[model samples]
Target: MINLYEVQETNKMIEESNLDVRTITMGISLLDCCDTDVDKVCENIYNKITTQAKNLVSTGCEIENEFGIPIVNKRISVTPISLVGGSCCKTTDDYVKIAKALDRAALEVGVNFLGGYSALVSKGMTDSDRLLIESIPKALASTERVCSSVNVGSTKTGIDMDAVKLLGEKILETAELTKDADSLGCAKLVVFCNAPDDNPFMAGAFHGVTEGDAVINVGVSGPGVVKRALEKVRGEDFGTLCETIKKTAFKVTRVGQLVAQEASKRLNVPFGIIDLSLAPTPAVGDSVAEILEEIGLESVGAPGTTAALALLNDQVKKGGVMASSYVGGLSGAFIPVSEDQGMIDAVEANALTLEKLEAMTCVCSVGLDMIAIPGDTKATTISGIIADEMAIGMINQKTTAVRLIPVIGKDVGEMVEFGGLLGYAPVMPVNRFGCDAFVNRGGRIPAPIHSFKN
Candidate 1:
């Protein structure tokens, strides 16, 4: 428990291997803020968020300085706005007022991003849920530091085709509303199947109704650390490769445990789970694709790519569980095209396509993330894509999400830049096909047979 060598090794991992805590997120419940008047609802949300997260940023900075470990972002997540404003928010504009209030509170508290502008309509949509879903394009276009997500499917409730079809149009509207910024608003909106309650990552995080009033969740990432460890066992057998990744993951997660404990104690909040995802960045050598390449793949979309990803995802979870008692969220490998340089390179080389990426999500942490498509693509096609991903999550009982941006005034082979951690992406081509007849058949897809285990 008291050793100098372990501390020194952690420092080396930080300095050379790009190891760091990705986010320290505070999940604040807004259920008590509901009111009959829209104005009062907004006031309660603003006051609660600002008062609760007042010291979040400063505490994160203090931890970074005292421990010499970099904490990338301090953020917040709240109860789904649809539930919080159900009694008061009568119209789309009323829901958007709450969105503005959330953005204001985030700015005042000095957090990087605030999530939970969301509705959970897995089976069907209530009036409040429909209003919030309708307000997403305006809500995201009008706010900064506020992110939104909608859960359209779950293993128990099955998929909601109505919500999927509606969100297809809303995503396109969001792209048009923020076209001046390269359709950046859509980047802040995500559609999920089996979305987790305690996720600390942006654009998909929400404080589930099952959570306590307020808690602290930390997300830790270290793709570079894993890659460097693999290099040491480059020519070794499969058993050696697996062991190295497991041991390396254990060490990296310990650092996250330290940071989460410190942040919780200092902020007077209960400690939540640690999300040990291999979330890559645009920086050099900090890529999940590079890790796959290190695992002997020529490129990310080659014949054996999905197998390598499946192996990497399983091992990451195996070692992460051993390191922490409470491991939750999407705690596996992420394959965002824009965020990882190697993935971007693969796309430029015509090695990765949308179809291959969809196949990969069957095993990866999240599905079809941070991908840019052409503007002229039809809304039904987008809905079709969403339905396909939802089917995967529903069948496998895993959490999967889609964050697609139909960048306006751009086509395939063109580039769209979303600077600073939300990296740039090459606009990938989508299959020119029609699915209007299928998505228009608007009803829930019944849950799979295994879901009736109860």
Candidate 2:
């Protein structure tokens, strides 16, 4: 049972801070949907999604209304289609059809985004995986709500240099294909290291083979709630702030666990993980950067911000782990530049830079998310950013990702509005220094030593 003081503090956090549940993701495995015939496979894919996820949005809305807590996104993650399409597709066109099927299913189900239009090429790419990656640009340009991701590196498998190189080319292709659409296609793609299959977040979620046939995963968010809690102890020392955040996170994640368990029971699906990430939206109060500012930083990129973020991430995880049996995904604070108003302000004020944002990614949840760079930024630079983040995740053995958008024809300080949940981002500068040699090396960075144990 929760204590009265704790409940009061939690409510106070929600009242004062920007607090709301970010996403309630349902993971539906599609391994059983695989078939030798392309049409049958597509049919199975559609049937499985529509059948298993029919109640997802309605249930999420019901829970939101019952608890008075907003659930920002109700999403579905399925088995990586590359694996499912492996036996069926000999050419890239087959992959395109699969992408279309996914889009149709998502539209029918009224989901905001459907993930697992992805492939895990960390170790190596199968023929279908390569074909799927090759067709991403066309697939993304043709589809509406289908998000894509590629795991090019992991702690155990090391980095797949060939896949990384191909991904760089794919990024360039994706950028060019959707250049006219405000570069919206790139917004749907993510490159990850140590990516999790149970992740309910967009642009980088999939159903891992280890998961059950169907499950319910919850991603609870409350940056505003955390900020409000910190504001209550405005003049308090750092120790008190950390304590406050941990206590608040405990309550938030507890709600998430309860909601997830109930949803799973109601849906007759297994209970999946709770991703305790402070995923912010473009709303007024739901900003992760605001949480940092409440901790006394003048702005998000100010000095000592990283340390503060480190503490917040750690405490959120600590509190969340204690609250639930299974805690997974990028379970920390998300600082997507365009999605958070405070982050956008920080970027416009020159308080944040690409380099500084990269630095912050080292301590927080995801890396280089929703960042819009000049359209002319070289593919090598994009790859360089990816390599740098992958190196960080590789070294730390933690999950980190890059979801950057090269806004075509947009220069520094310019804004590209994606509208809706994607929001808008100011065009940020990228490293002018040519990393041609480093990225051109075009060889796999071997797995870390830590991965070799046993």
Best by TM-score: 1
**lDDT of model 1, residue 278:** 94
Among all windows of ten consecutive residues in candidate 1, which has the lowest summed lDDT? 235-244
lDDT of 1 by residue, 106-224 (tens): 99999989999999999999999999999999999999999999999999999999999999999999999999999999999999999999999998999999999999999999999
Model 2 lDDT per residue over 1-454, tens place: 7788966765665566656677888888899988999999999999989999998888888887876666778898989889999999888889999999999999988898989889988888888889999989899999989999999999888888777777777887787889888889999999999998789899888888899998888899888777766877998987888888888788889878877887887788889899999888898988888888888899989998898889999999988888899998889999899999999999999998988988988898889899998889888878888988988888888898999898778899888999987899899998899887888886678898889989
Q: Residue 33 deviation, candidate 2, in Å?
A: 1.5
Q: How do the predictions measure up, each by TM-score?
A: 0.99, 0.96
> Against the true structure, whose lDDT is highest?
1
Q: Global lDDT for candidate 2?
A: 0.87
Clashes of 1: 0
TM-score of 2: 0.96
